[model samples]
Every structure is written in C-alpha cells, then in structure tokens.
Target: MILKLVSYAGNLFGFLFLTLSIASGLYYISELVEEYSEPTKRFLTRAIYGVIGLLVSLLIFDKFPFKLTVFAIASHVLYLQNMKGFPFVSFTNPTFLLSCACTVLNHYLWFKYFNDVEIPPQFKFNPNYIPKKRATFSEVASFFAICVWFIPFSLFVSLSAGDYVLPTAEELKKTDDPTAQPKLRKRTINLVRVAINNVRGFIRSSLRIFGFKIAEPEYDRLSI
Candidate 1:
C-alpha cells in the first residue's frame, strides 16, 4: 500500500513538473515574439511559401505519394488564409480551426505512410525475404518537425489571443444614456499569458483548498 501511494505521488509530481515546464516555455516564446510581431509575420509568410515549394518538389520527384503530397500542398494553402490577420488570431475562426484539423490529419497520414512496409509478391512467398526497413524514430520526428509542425508552431508563437476594437464615437453616441460612463474594455493578452494566468489561478485555488492563504497575482495589471 505504501509503495503504491508513493508511486502515485511520484507520477503526479512528474506530470505537474512537465506541465509547468511546457507552460513556462510557451509563455516565454509568446512574450518574445509579441515584441517582434511584424518580422515574425513576414518570416512565417515566406516559410509557408517554402513549405509549399518543398511539397511540390517532393511530388515532382515521386518522393512522397502523389495524393498525400497534393493534400499537404492544399493544407499549406489553407494555412495561408490564416495569415490574413496575422498575430491576431480568433480561436473560433473557421479558417484557423480548419488549419488545426489539417495539421493533425497531415501528421497522422504521413506517420502511417512512413511506418508501413509493403512486401513484394516474391517476398510474400519466400519466408526468408524481408521488406524494406521502416522509417526510424529519428527520421519520423525530423519529418514532423520540419513539415507537419513548423507552421502551426510558428503561428502559435506569433499569434495573439485577440484585441478589443474600441467602439467608434458614432456608435458610442447612440447609447441610451449620455451621462453614463462607458464600460471598461477587457484587456487582451496572448494565449500564453492566458495559460499562465490559468495555471496561477489553479495553484491559488488548490492552496486555498489546503487551508493556506494566497494573495492574488498582479499579472492583470501588466500588458503582454
């Protein structure tokens, strides 16, 4: 019983540590990119074009399956649509959501293709014959890093959560009460900042549940 309890505790600790590490890294990258949004946007635009060219080259050389290569190219074209409002992404946008779905689909299809081994007719009858070797873990990982994940990861780092458009003076004038003060606009922060805030909030709540007093963080006052 003691051993089981210790194992559970260790697993929980490791999970929490990993989660915090990833969240911290994301927050740092998001913050850094927020400062150079224009340059990052330009670079990502060029990168998307380059990826498309790579896909075309692979297709021309018969390196990748024709249908799969075409699909990959189409997905990158969709990725370009997401750049219309670069650095200010709507999580609910159809184009953004579709691009995300394509990323997962592309990864799944390519991974399956790489891992599959097809035996020749002669090999099928011969017990000693072996099919070509499957892609190694390192090769699969590198392919995913360069082709499947590059754009999506870059977008995540460069895109902001969103910003509020201040109400126009003409619209504000249409309000029923001229004397009433306008409601405060909620401050916009990047996704990384939001994730950090949520993690901090969860920690505070957990501490409170354990009968410990925790002060609220002043993250709300700072701009991302």
Candidate 2:
C-alpha cells in the first residue's frame, strides 16, 4: 500500500515528504549547531527503543509497510553514527553524498516530529581540525545550483537512455473460482477503503500534532 504510492512519480507526495524531511533536517541541524554536535543518548535511546518496539509490533502484526517505516528510522541512526566525524566542509566533500546524509537526518526528524530529543553540545575539536564557518548567502546559492542542475540533468540522461522504472503493486493472490473472484474483489475494495480511512485519520491526527519538543534539560547539558 505504501509502496503503491511510491511506485508512481509521487511528485506532490514526494515533495511533501521531502519538505517534512528538509524541515526536520534543518531544525535538527540548527539545534545541533546551536548547542550540541549530537543528540543526547537519552532521547536517542528512547527513539531506538521506540523503533525496537515498533519492530516488535511489526513482527507480531506481519506488516511490511510498518516494518519499512521503522527500518527507515533505524537506517538514519546507523547513518548518523557512521558520519558523526565527517566535517561539514571539505575539498572532496561530496555534495550529493552530504545531501543524502541531510536527507536521512531530515527523515529521522520527520519520524520523530512530535517527540523531544536532547542535542548534546560539541565541545571537543582537535586543534588542527578547523571547522568551516557558517555557510554564507553566496555559499547557499551555490549549493542550490547543484540541486537545480543535477535533478533535471539526471532526468534528461534517463530520457536519453530510455531508462525509467515504472512501479506496480505486488499481486495479492491468483484467482480461479468464479465466486472467489467477487469475494477477492470485495476484500480488495475493503482494504482500499480501510487504507483511505487510516490516511484520513492520520491527516486529522497530524493536524493536531504540531510543534517541536526539545528536551530542555538535555539541551542545557549540550555544552561541555
């Protein structure tokens, strides 16, 4: 069901997801810059625990989409751990790669939007490890240039190569019995109906669930 939506171009939906991801990413990044190099383990650990519990529920429920969502969060945690030492600026710093990292962080923030996390301050820096200064407007403009150029460029290349993947949903079952066909049709309809309602419910819930919560005490401990 989740994959079905993703199977298509998903332009608006993808952009919405990206917006959520970017907003979350930027906020988390801002918090990190303001105080900590990383989030406090308490909040992070809670997120880990929540993900674990979600995984357990997925196992019990045998829900693939549920599992994928949890795995996505777990993916970010692993990603963060791997890139923790990476400096924001480098001669060889791959912008796309960094963008991907930023995307993951954004995804995590979206996943945990309602929750509070403690960002720990970065107090330790090697004497020789000179951090890059904040990105200026020109620097920001230059970075956007890469994004503007790359996405369209890739689209063009894909068109030139005639390489675009069209996605389709996994077939649920094969049918034979005439009576069973109606039953299957009915079931599919019911599933679609249920999914729609769930989505509607989520929208309503999301509307009410606004605001970013940072763990105040943990935020205070950011400075070493």
Candidate 3:
C-alpha cells in the first residue's frame, strides 16, 4: 500500500510538472507572437524543419510511431499558418487554435513515450502484441527542453515590458546617472538573472544528491 501510494504521488507530481511546462510553453509562444513577430516566425520555421528532419531520421532508423510523426508535422504546418499575416493574426485564428490542440497532443504522446507508461487496460485491444518501444529519459528531456520549453524559459530571461518606453536623448541627459537602466529594464534583468542563478543552484543541489561533488558558486546578486 505504501509503495503504491508513493508511486501514485510521484505520478501526480510528474503530471503537474508536465502540465505547467506545457502551459508555460504555450504562454511563451503567444507572447512571442505579440512581441517578437518576425524573429519568432523565423525561429518556428527553422524548428519545424528540424523536427521534420528528426522525424525522418526516426522513421528510417528507429521504431517511432507513425501517428506521432503525422501529428508533429501537422502541428508545425498549423504553427506556420499563424505567421502568414506577420503578427496581425488573431489569437483565435482557427489554425493557431488547432496548433495549440496539437501541441497538447504531442506533449501527451511524448510524455507517455518517455515515461514508459502502458496504455490503460481499457484501451488495450491487443494485449499480446503491444508496442513497447520508448525514448530514453535523456532524449525525451532534451527534446522537451529545446523544442518544447526553450521559448518559455528564454522569455523568462529576455522579456522587458517596462523598457518598452524608451527615454529621449534630452531626458537621458537630464538623468543624474547616464548609465542607469530604465525601471522596467532593470527589473526584468534582475528577474532573469535571479532565475538563472536559482536554476544553477538547483542543478548543483541535484548533482550533490547523486554523489557528484559540484561546487556551488556564490552569486553577486540575489537569486530566487
């Protein structure tokens, strides 16, 4: 009973982490659409190409599922549709909405694949010959980090709403400190800096847990 309870709790925590990551990813993409327009479009286009390349390689050399390849390719095409109007597209555009849905589908499929979770018993039609292949944990984690979660994490590091309103040259000369950052820019920088430090600290701690003697570096600034 205790082991079962622990397993259940672990699964719950994993589920929460996965859900939050997906939410953060979608939020990041939406914000990119709002702010970075052209650059974001280019990035997504390249990302889709990369994903297609990976899918093709997998098809040739790995036992990856066919349905997932189709889903991923379709999702990228849907995402490209959002770039058609160059940032003028509505959030409610049908293609974009469908892309979000496909994003969730991809997440679900990859999560299950990486975690080695079996299909639920009710859904197991062919009990004797179920496909059991799964990606290694490292592969899945790296994929999520680069392909799925990079935007959200980078947005946390780069977005500066307050710095949007720049001071004029005359206003800059009036300031006592010429080097002083705008309030919003300073705040955003601090937030990103602290976040990066905190992530470093967490990685250090986790490494220590695994018997790796990583030195914890002291930050000059406050960390989260």
Candidate 4:
C-alpha cells in the first residue's frame, strides 16, 4: 500500500493529466517569476515562489501529497503566527497526486500572508537563492550515479547500526555474563559483512554506470 503511493507516476489519467500539470506548473511558476521580477512585486512574488519551492521539494521527496500537505498547510498557519523566517514543513510530496493539492494550498497561503504586504526590494528572491540554471548532462549522470549509490548506502546504514549501537540484551548481558566477549566478536563480524556488501554495491553500481560490463548481477550470474 505504501509502496504503491511512492512509485513514479507520469500522468494523472494516462498521459493527459500529467502533461497538463507539468505545463500548468511551469507556466504558473514562470508567470509568477516574471511578475515578481518587478521591484514593487517583491513581497507577493516571494510568497508565491516559496509555495512553488515547497511543491518541488515534496515531489522530489516523493511522498503522498495529502498527508504531508496537511502538515504544510497547518505549518503555514503556524508560520504566520510564529514567523519562523524559514520554510520548514512545506517540503515533502508523499506522492505525485499531491502536487495538485499542494499547489492550491500554496497559492492560498501566499495570498493570505503576502497579498497586501509592501516589503522593500533589498530583501527578496535572488536568482541564486532560487536557482534557474539549466542542468547539463554531467548533472543528470551524477544524479543517477547518486541514486544508485543511495540504495546501497541506505542498506549499509541499516545493517551497520548494530556496530555503533549495542542491542539492549547485550548491555544487560555484559553486567552478569563473563561470556560477553563473544558479543563483541559477533558485532565485529556483522560490521565486516556490511562493509564488504556496501563496498561491493558501490563498485558494482559505479562500474555499471560507466558502461563497464565485467561484474555479474549475481555471483553465479557470471559467464565463464
């Protein structure tokens, strides 16, 4: 159930809705960016940009839109009261279906908070803060490289957590059992296996990304 929500979704209803949202999101953002470019439009536009940034952050994170969005909306109302001076909760998509709800909520929040503010231009959205630089091939290659690396690194973290952390039973065992020595040895052995597996994954992924064909998918998958 949870996995179904996180998988890649291209179109809303087949390809039609996907194309529409992408077009609309880009247009809405571009128009907002252009309008916000003017000196007097700083406050209103900054709020809009913040909303867009939140949406992108959520989509990238890939969670369900509704769950995290409710959190973001509630967070926004709190922000107006507390004024954290930073966007803390508006990021997290939960899933692609969420983009719609998030976008609407963001616009509503922008209007509510900044529709009438007349803040000065010196403190506003710099292009640097909201990067618009076109990503090159190297950037994409690096991204895929990192994604592949992340899968293994994440597994390694789970597997090796025992090394830095003692199981509850072991801590209790150490007090009364003189045989606690074997516990440490078991921990070391587990760490060694994790290290070997993690390194193997990284090397295998790195080789595959760069087009090297030597490594087999499975140990026995190798051809003689």
Off by over 4 Å in 3: 1-40, 117-134, 147-224
Candidate 4 lands at a TM-score of 0.18
Give a tens-digit lDDT track for model 4, residues 1-224.
66665443433355767655654554354334333334323443344346545545654674424554555544333333211211111223232124334445655653343233443465465544542234456754563333222222222222222123345664766577665543332221122233444556677889889999855546421111
**Among all candidates shown, the one with the greatest lDDT:** 1
**Full-model lDDT, candidate 1:** 0.81
lDDT of 4 at 89: 18
Q: Which stretches of candidate 4 lie over 4 Å from their true place?
A: 1-135, 161-188, 191-224
Per-residue lDDT of model 2, residues 74-137, tens digit only: 5445433423332122223364355455555544543453232433246244455444444456
lDDT of each: 0.81, 0.40, 0.60, 0.40
Whichever of 3 and 4 has more lDDT, that candidate is 3
Q: Which of the two candidates, 2 or 4, achieves a greater TM-score against the reference?
A: 2
Q: Of the pair 1 and 3, which is ahead by lDDT?
A: 1
Write one digit per residue (lDDT tens) for candidate 3, span 40-136. 6576567667766776677677766688766766666666665565434334568756766777777787677667767777668875766766667
TM per candidate: 0.76, 0.23, 0.45, 0.18
Find the candidate with the highest TM-score and give its number. 1
TM-score of 1: 0.76
Which regions of candidate 2 are displaced past 4 Å? Answer: 1-33, 38-42, 65-74, 83-224
True-structure RMSD for candidate 3: 11.9
By lDDT: ranked, best first = 1, 3, 4, 2
